[model samples]
Target: MNARTGPLSDVRILDLTQALAGPFCTMLLADLGADVIKVEPPGGDMSRTMGPHPNDRAGTDYGGYFASVNRNKRSVVLDIKTDGGREAIFKLAATADAVVENAKTGVMDRAGIGYDRLRKIKPSLVYAAIRGFGDPRTGRSPYADWPAYDIVAQSMGGLVSITGPAGSDGFRAGPGVGDIYPGTLAALGVVSAIHAARRTGHGQFLDVAMYDAILTLCENIVYTYSRAGVVRGPQGNGTPVLCPFDVFRSRDGAVAIAAPGENHWAILCNAIGRPELIADDRCRNNPKRVANAEFVREAVSAWTTAHTTQEIVAAIGGRVPVGPVNTAKDIFADPHPRARGMLIEVDQPGDNPPLTIAGCPIKFTETPSGIYARAPLLGEHTEQILAEAGITDASKEKS
Candidate 1:
């Protein structure tokens, strides 16, 4: 019944990241039951102060942003700038399965705790890094030293170029996929490297660049530009290739309708009481329908606009792919998330009421993963973690 009993139960990771990318990667590892020891500098991760703090919990521990991404892990503060701190991290790294960081290219190297240095202590240590551009260990980029955030990656990696309304100047995505995607890829790289290390007893330096990861996420653009000589632009709610795969208006709110396949198309036509559109030459196949997108869009819009979102769902919920565009309130009220264990309620100290955070999406029947503990207060587990690492007298180290 222990929460920290999963696939990565025996693995240990030294997390030396601040802000989004690195913390997110290690957070995933922690979620999988890895002993992720978050190594924060003296002042702690910059994200600790990035607020959206609950009104009742003002000036109490870390803010929501830090809490959200850093659950199920231990925190230990160390001044990597100091000789004592450097010695402590190397000692911890020697006993760790992997080390993860997301600072700019040479930040860790400048601190004397880079991949090369850690590998010297534990030859089989998986040193994973998430960077804005990339590390030279894995093909350096010209912009390796440049600092970047979500917006920069989205714009530079071709995502923003094809986002937003079709005629608009494109917009950055609401969520920070620029950071999140790279973090996800970094987690994969770390795990993969760990897998390889377990077999070969040799670990290597691996990195996921925000720019590269986003480009990979936008694979369609790469293939289209290469094969079809088309540079895609902002597509709004629908793609140029899918005919009825667009968000449409409803009486109360919006609903997304995707009936691209012939069978689904026929079902949608029937649901909308327009079965004749199925035989219409311009709307026959996917290609023709895509060419006549405006007509298809208008037809679907006509039906959706006449009905409420609930009515639309009732008509074609299972017959074709259709869903109401949900708001925060909608998600909280919906039963699907609750039924699937997607909404996990956790207590936020100092905040009178508990807060619900999204649960782990990766489920396993035999080795399940989940949120076990809330995020730590700054260096909350410092002495305990050091004791576990056999550093009984950690008083000399900053915490």
Candidate 2:
């Protein structure tokens, strides 16, 4: 059976977000059958210009960045500067379950689309605003007006300080957690508010800041600082408190191993043919491993170097929690991704190699999630969405 029945079937969302984070959130809702109408400014979203075209052919307002996160959603272009545009949005918000945007702080307020204004129009409306630091009253006063990206949040939220190694340069995590996480939180918040409205007939004013969300992504550091008065530094590979829990280069690629506790460590030691490690005093427990990490890592790396990634996984995985660090090809070829409906083939007439994105992640026994449509051509659904809002003036409208 096809995975089509979604959870948020009747919900409607006015999407004004762009780039990775905000779009990712709406994509989740859209995949789950939410009526997500992405409202772009007159020229359209900046993501359309971001590269990795469909088939290296004529650009059709498509970007790999845009395609990956935005699917099963309609598109609408509106110049909110015009009175007709503002009225169109007001009309949409009146009936919509939620409105989402990722503008710099106060931009929405200046444009007359802030939560305060929208809530007045629709009392039970949920306004989801994704900002860089936070809203004006939420401690991002200084940077509220300043522009930000994923790296900015990574640096300010303490992730850059703790990434990499002792001597390596500070770095951001591979993914844009700064934007994505906040957007995710905002989406979750919007749905929660919608649920509340369903029961109480009152919506919420929600704002998720990239800095705030990314900060939550690395919460252990905060507690560690508060309790022990010890600040964490650049740490590469394994977790600070665990042993044999890092990536190692195999003959071909790499593999990740995790020996979180003493039991797992003992099992790994046996697998590596170093049974004496269990009795070693300096390497006996977790605290000891944290103190003498370099020595233990060196010993483990040396042992792992002799085996293939798969061999190492077979030898220590499950028993000692080892796993192979796979690449894109590995993921595409893996049997599990196919079986679990995590990977799907999309028909693209304009593609040379064809477009295939990671499928919807939600899995329900009765209602499953799957891709319904590709990113729309610029303003493809402008009229369609406006019609849904019952707007008669198609030539002059904002969606």
Q: State which candidate has the highest lDDT.
A: 1
Structural similarity to truth (TM-score) of each candidate = 0.97, 0.93
For candidate 1, write residues 246-280 as lDDT tens digits: 99999999999999999999999998999999999
Model number with the top TM-score: 1
How does each model score on lDDT? 0.89, 0.81
C-alpha RMSD values across all candidates: 1.6, 2.3
lDDT of 2 by residue, 23-133 (tens): 988988888878888888878888988867766556456767777787788888888887788888888889799999888877888899788899999999988888887
Lowest summed-lDDT stretch of 10 residues in model 1?
A: 390-399
